[model samples]
Target chain A: EFIRKLWEGLLVQSKPPLTSHFPFPAQIPPDLVDKLERLALVDFRTKQGLECLEKAIRFADQLHVVDTTGIEPMDSVLEDRALYLREDTAVDGGCAEELLKLSRKTVEEYFVVPPGNIPLPKKEERSSMLKHSEL
Target chain B: MLGLTLKEVSLAFREGRISPTELCRKCLNRIKKTQHLNAYITVTDELSLTQAQESERRLQRGVPKGPLDGVPFAVKDNFCTKNVRTTCASRMLKDYVPPFNATVVQKLLDQGAVLMGKTNMDEFAMGAGSTDGAFGPVKNPWSYTEPYRTLAGPEADWVIAGGSSGGSAAAVASLTSYLALGSDTGGSTRNPGALCGVVAFKPTYGLLSRHGLIPLVNSMDVPGILTRSAGDASVVLSVLQGVDVRDSTTVPAPSSHAELPEEFDVRNLCVGIPKEYHALGLSPDTRAQWSRVADLFEAAGARVEQVSLPHTQHSIVCYHVLCHAEVASNMARFDGVEYGHRSSMDSSTEAMYATTRHEGFNDVVRGRVLSGNYFLLKQNYQHYFVKAQKVRRLICDDFRRVFASGVDVLLTPTTLTDAARYGDFTQEDNRTRSAQEDVFTQPANMSGLPAVSVPTALSSRGLPIGLQLMGKALDDHRLLAVAQWMERQVGFPSIGVHDDYRQCSDTSSTVQTSA
Candidate 1:
């Protein structure tokens, strides 16, 4: 209500109220529900349930900057976003599958080890995983 | 001449060897001889004499004021002194004298360090070289002086005394006064001290009171001292360190009284050298000197080890962002509202504010302020400002982790290269050199740790190279302990009278004739 009054005072048209219409149960993305839950983590987008979309938009720009000298915005839906959407859609292991694909592709494209390069021994990690010998 | 350290001068007054009047006269004489060095902004002759008389009478009546009693010292103009002009080396405060003394200055006065004068600096302490002062460049006092010392013609060699604290550094280097006070946010104290061949010590953040020093970057700026020796720096610091209610940042750490473990005790002392600091841009002479310093530590029975401060490489960039952001915010208070120079313009009140600031600040300060505002734009703030703050945290954590690994102190070269020609780093590529120059020093400021730069060796070109000793957070005394030991070993020669003239003229290229 405060936002509506502020927008009106600023001579701005109120954005159309978000439709309460629900998607078909069969058409719902597997990750859609999880994405809606994740939106609660973001203070601004908690009530709107739009954090997955926000990350989809923001992380895309970050990925571009890291990938192509800050140019060449990606065309296809990124695997991370797809994984987030899958988690929201409640698909079985769909998020994990998409995440694996994203990580593998990112490693291959951005961090491939170059030939004839000597790599230093990795310093000991402080993580508990290193202590437990898990995975 | 008033040839005494602040402590020594106080002792002399106690012994009746000389009066404060005589000491002030000697400082005045030195100021006259090297007037061209441009070290001072305002000389407080009357004020100094009055203070001197008070100190003398106290001594005569079997009462002594303090450790720095009857000792003359100069302050960087940025620090407010009651009823005295505190310009911050800019025109904005050219005629502005504050009604109160900065807390640090007040503390020093209460301790009896007589204020001889206010010194010159980079306008708002923005430049590395003192060339950006509203007054002008402060010539380095250690120029080559040889054959035919007295030249009447319009020819002589001269260079800058370092920047920000260049005036204070010059004063101490020439023995014009025993010690001078300056502020260092980034490399202001250490850089100028390296160039001028003096001892510059920046204590742990919040250790010294900063209530009166005009804010450059509130989080980064700390009141530091410039003196002739590490011992003197330590003595002055002893008097100054305490928790002040005025500066809320002051920590509750007790004054450092415990002596550092002897250098020979290899049982626990570990000195960590960050691999990132040994980068390619360091001068060959500087590298050799650093190796020599490391070798000395090894000989003294200390275990030296290589440590990786991965975040160290990003410290300078992060420091610039955070400092400039704070500067933008702090300097906005100077918009000619209650005091300071106000400019008249045809535009609106807001436009007048813009014009006043544009005309009031020098180019270097204006550039940083503008760049800071640009970085703080709503969309870009998260990308640059937030990232920089996060990186600053990471840099601090790196030091904490390094110290946690049992390294008591860190060693690095004070500067990437020896001091350059006056205008060498003053181009559009200033950021490249500026960032690179503070490569070794900024992390300490970021981490709020203590660091000191002491002259280690003279380069092939006759300029001094400095070695930096950085201690764990709030372990300032230990840093001084290691520095004092190193200072005694290196033993850089004191500056001579003719050196100043040689640096300012073109013909100052030859070796010293006398000595």
Candidate 2:
């Protein structure tokens, strides 16, 4: 259920780190723990990331000293300058061949990543879920 | 040859008394001689010699590149150099060579500046003691103390060169290079600069391009210049600052602005010394030095007053969260797939990624990445990452409020303490030490303000005590001008080669005896 809640939180929220939508957990679940353990947190050579995680939790409570009421959560921009987007265009500086040289497995124009164990969505289940949502 | 300032070197070259090739050879010899500082990860002997020959040819033609022509300098290894190994002092990029030069490196190259070597730094710029890098601890060139660690190994008491950019500062102070480029992600440049008696400048964010520099914190990381004098910083900053098409976040340079004024009058200036900084457990020597700087400013007809930045206590804690959060995000691309070292190659990609990171990263890097990932998780995102960002704003706002009230600049001590021993620095671990190292310097990065650390006085330990001056964001030229005025007023002594690498007389504490 905790994992489901986390998964749901990720889906519904477009802007992340929303302080509005969380009852933060005391500890990481095993699957997320396992994923973190797989991603950057190794089990053997380095211990599981519980120490850092706990430190983060403890430190997170310190911000409550200030009343953050009516203050919009700050984003990267501090100055109110208008951002002008450049027109969509490709520049010639990119040297694809040189960049490709760094790739471990490349076949002609495409990068060859190792086989990922991602499960494909079942067609019947997808249709049933879509029908239930009345889309 | 190592005694002259960079301008003096340029003058000698202009007067035809010295050739670029000769200067390069002299610098190369000095770098070779100072191998004990561990200042460089890779000294580009052939590359610098080749560049020197080209610069010499230009000089002979009577069309030199610029003021920096033939001036030897070093870039922190984090900056990529095409066909050169650019390690961020990590085993991951130990054997990895780059196919491109960082825009800043290319800029220096354009000026025909001699490239000496790539300096060593904390692994991925994560630590403050400069001890955790793969090359080992960068020794403080000013450490002329007892119980020296040189021959006794860990049992002696020698000082640190300062962190993440320790090699850069040490190289400049030791006369190995005229100037060295160090990335200041919360004091990576200035901390080392303070300890080594060099000028470290963190310019306003987006004022300098971040192209080709390895990302530490995308918002805060900019290539900082380490120089022997405040004026030298201005020269280098002028060359490095501009809009980089590759980096869109750059603040577009003004369409029409005079070249940064190398001189300014000190009269009628309002300088603020933030009161919150004094509460950070300042040492007696540091306190005296801080007061001396304020007195100098006042005597020079500038208004130096104590100002409040109430949110200062939270800045270090705030920086810790922000730095790790970004490190995790930025370093995610280093999975064993493309550029860096690939270890534990296996059929399973997930396993390969985990194993590669574990082996490639040091404990400091891994811990930061893990904590960063934990904070970024959807469930805890607001409670950690967002809260930290909000506090970051409050800190920035504190500066804005202070700057708004007739204050042209703010003054503060660059570091809480003078040079610390390697054994002492490593006691608290990287995470804790980094927070303290960044206490004063992080506010500049946090608020996107321009700050420079100029040497003011020698500490009781015979180390450099740096005084920092911060100005409003986007006013880098003005800040540099003020720093130059202060630099002239203080008249701090320069580091001489005679003082370093001497044997210690007092063997009071061993590594075992230290806390």
Candidate 3:
């Protein structure tokens, strides 16, 4: 229903499809669907996102027809090249001091986020979560 | 003074014929003269002059950083430059200023290369025609004489400076800068470089540091260079290399591969022309040019043959899936809390995130982000994302097998045609056009191989036609050496504003020999 509501009027009808309609729909449970879609952005698909997404789905479906049965999932093409790695140690990236200034709320030089998984007393619990930027 | 190549400009700077200040003024003046081209996002006029004067003083003291010292260059908007509003031609970063420079920019500054400004690009480097950026499309500097039946408007005659790095290509073509840095996920650098009649080089993945480059598809993204010739590209490449702790993907420079050789031998080398690249959509002129280039190599004593990578058709589909998924994940960092555009409307933090993203992102970015989330969903993950990645493995293996067969490099057209005119180019919606144009360039990025696009000939109307050369992962030096030889053999006139550049000038002569 979330996607059905969002998909109705969002796509541009002017051009004939460069590709066919996707053969399979996202087969997730209805409840989990909106939750993940929410994480991507609001499900409305305004700003041509719905069209953007529709194209990807159609292309992905086109790719799905080709048999990729035994192929291993590829990751880290660099790891294939035998590249050298820097040792893990703390170094100044100049992010904290500069970035903290942009946050609307902060506490004692640390940027603050709304209450979520972590309890306020334990700073280590928050520190343990990985930063997406680092990845 | 007006039409000198990057090497000639460097020589002039050294000989005291032109001071860095004078050189920068010339660049600024050139940019001013061609404002309709819309090549830059910001022009850094006073700051450029200040930096140029410093370089001039340093040269007077008899200590210069390197060959690039006192040279002026532009950077694609995607690369972050400190305090110099590094917008990726998107509203999200429309007013955001970086606290630090991208590693490549810092490296150039260290070499005393004057920063001219950030050039325009597709929003988040997502589009192919450089026409989709927030600042509007970059116009091709080439004489736009083509009267296409499908094209329209006041700029109808103007060919599109190929995109997402369209600004860089147009800038170098217009003589706004000596060289410009652009990011290539598939063919962003080379496409525009080809369209604008210049040399564009995408280094082997991870060779140049990606620390400050705004992420598009991180796995495929590499910092690329655009300049007047292959030799200038080699000069810029040596400066912008080295590992960074900030970006773990970068490999430490093996000292031997850093510098390109002065000369390369074509004798006894093997070149492959993939049969799959000879698709129906390739124009007759492009097809003939490909064969003529192969003949040139054969005549010069290198072995050239038709090779097959049957999986080529599936690459664009696989590339879209993989590229969209990564764009979704990378763009997640642009929420309202810390940096970038924050929404004014508030309900809860959830509403804030949604509104900010809706307001901040354009249709192209939001679409990919949404689809990425859908692909990564637990139920769809196996069917879409993983399958695409697995196909990527096949693509990688294709290059590996071909290289294993002793074909040192593969040759292909950089784009299907010469610079596309704006009206005809935009008539096809973004995604369709992007897919078709990227077909020839995607394999190199997908496999992490080095690729460079150098002008082979001009179109019937004076626009550039680029031919690409792909090489082994770390053998960038060798690839450039071969490209340099091709450059020497063609003697393709390097283009600029004041010079009388002709359309398809050499094709008349080559057509006689090949036909």
Candidate 4:
């Protein structure tokens, strides 16, 4: 719950970041803007806000605040709060997917695609006897 | 000689001087002769012939679609065309074909520009030179000397064309097509145009629609053109510019039929010289040429002043980080899945996807994608991506502040050194080389301001030299008009060496140092 609140607060609707603390701003290198937007959560109040949230997330991740291994069983919301304060991260907008991914079911969805497989075509004996020209 | 601007090509057809069929034939012939320049990845000769026949029928009916109606043109390979292979110059999409045309391609076809073929580019438009492309490097038509063998080998004697729009620039330079479409994230369009002695224009962001374009950086990837002249660029822009529902980024501004101020007066123009552009790395010969050109502008009554773009130093680092992030995202769509080339996924989905990408993409693109992923890993995104974005804002402010302070346009060299040998940019030291190459061009892109690189004169080695003119966002017409006027004043020689291949025999350094 603490991590959730922290994610919420960090991503809460806010103005576009004028500072470099976020992933994207009104002006950044085209490449960097591209980077921030890609990782950025689109759920922010504005496009700019989403970019900011991305930057904040990136900042925390770089500081080793985000545990990539997923080994710890600590509450996600609590983890987020620790990251928010400890990393001093600020995001102009919130990312819905990131928050959702911290939930139980969504984690499975992130790892799965269509599970069914296509069966190989089976040829009938009559069809197999057909010549190339006849076929 | 089919000496026709894209606009003139249509005019000629209307005047009965040439039929669209004949024009297509001529263009086909040129491509056949000059394809050695590696200007194209695929030549849809059959498709082009069919389109030309259809255009002839339309001409007979006296119903013209638009100015570009029946004008032969090519697009950089990154754009999707219904069934044509759109590689983005990487093996990842070597056999991939999109089901739909990019919004820009649709607009062009609707305006009646004939599709000649898809041109080559740096893989995913990532490199300064076209060397990083999967097909092969594009050769400069102007840099040709003798025997016309392509630098790629003895059978293909074309010179190194400037890139990543090297193919587009070379095509237009050699009359392979009337106009060619290119995408500019930085100086891609202008740099090649300058090196190839053509007019390349990157309009203000949102001026030209970017829908369906394979995204480089969403904000910076503006569709641009390489043509023979600024007026022709205007003609092509007229056909391509407008808000489209598909591309949400395009501005709602209607096409501006703004007239070129009848007599261009450089007297009222304020040209800013950023101190950062004149740093120590600039060659003496280049500096001399720059000074001479500046003097020419002054003699023509233009007011020139030195100014500082303080945040200029961070442009390269910021652009690289940002570009990598975008690459990481844009490329995610190419994971051998539903849309693109799929490899046998005997392994897990992620593993299969990784293997496909690893096998399919070239080294340069893969390196950039990995770097982008690393940069955005939760922790790095904040410090690198966010900080880069902030720096980007400062870059934009630098341009805004300069223009607001009475500077109508900013002038700088397009690249510090003329086209280096193709191998110079691929080594580990590429970061330094790339930085020097992008010095004058990145700021304009970072700010979303319009910039044009016009060929001013030849370098000491007979390579072309260009001066960039940057304008306030959306003020593209003025920059082009001024460029057109300057083009008239200092008519630079066309690097027409492909037709006369005896100029490049000697590989002496003096060739680069001579006037």
Tens-digit lDDT string for candidate 1 (B202-271): 9888788888888888777888788877778887887778777666666655566533334524435788
TM-score: model 2 vs. ground truth:
0.87
In the order shown, the candidates' DockQ scores are: 0.01, 0.13, 0.20, 0.02
True lDDT of residue B105, candidate 4: 87
lDDT of each: 0.66, 0.76, 0.77, 0.67
Ranked by TM-score, the better of candidates 1 and 4 is: 4
Q: Tens digits of per-residue lDDT for model 2 on B1-515? A: 67677777888899999998998998888887777778899999999999999999999999998989999999998999988899999888997788888999999999999999999888988877677887777878776432223334534466888888989999998898999999998888989999888999998888778888999999788789898877778788888888787777777654323234556766779888776676435778887777777777777777766678888778777777788789988889898677787654454565456556766777778778877877787876887788888888888889989989989999888998888877667777676677678888988898888899989887666678998989988788788788888888888888665555544443322222110
RMSD (Cα, Å) of model 2: 10.7
Model 1 interface Cα RMSD in Å:
32.4
TM-score, one value per model = 0.75, 0.87, 0.87, 0.75
Residues B1-515, candidate 4, lDDT per residue (tens digit)?
35567766788888878888898999898788775677899998999998888888888799878778888999999888877889888767787767678887888888777899999887888766666677777777765633223333343323356667778887888788888988888778887877777888888877777766888887578887888777788777777777776665666444465344557889888877776676555666566666766667778888877777876766766677777777778877775554454545433444345445655665456555656775677876666676666667666767879989999988777877666654444442333344556767877778777888787877666666778888887788888888887777777775442455333333321121100
Q: How accurate is candidate 3 locally (lDDT)?
A: 0.77
Name the 10 consecutive residues with the lowest summed lDDT in model 1 chain B: B506-515
Report residue B230 deviation for candidate 3 (angstroms): 0.6
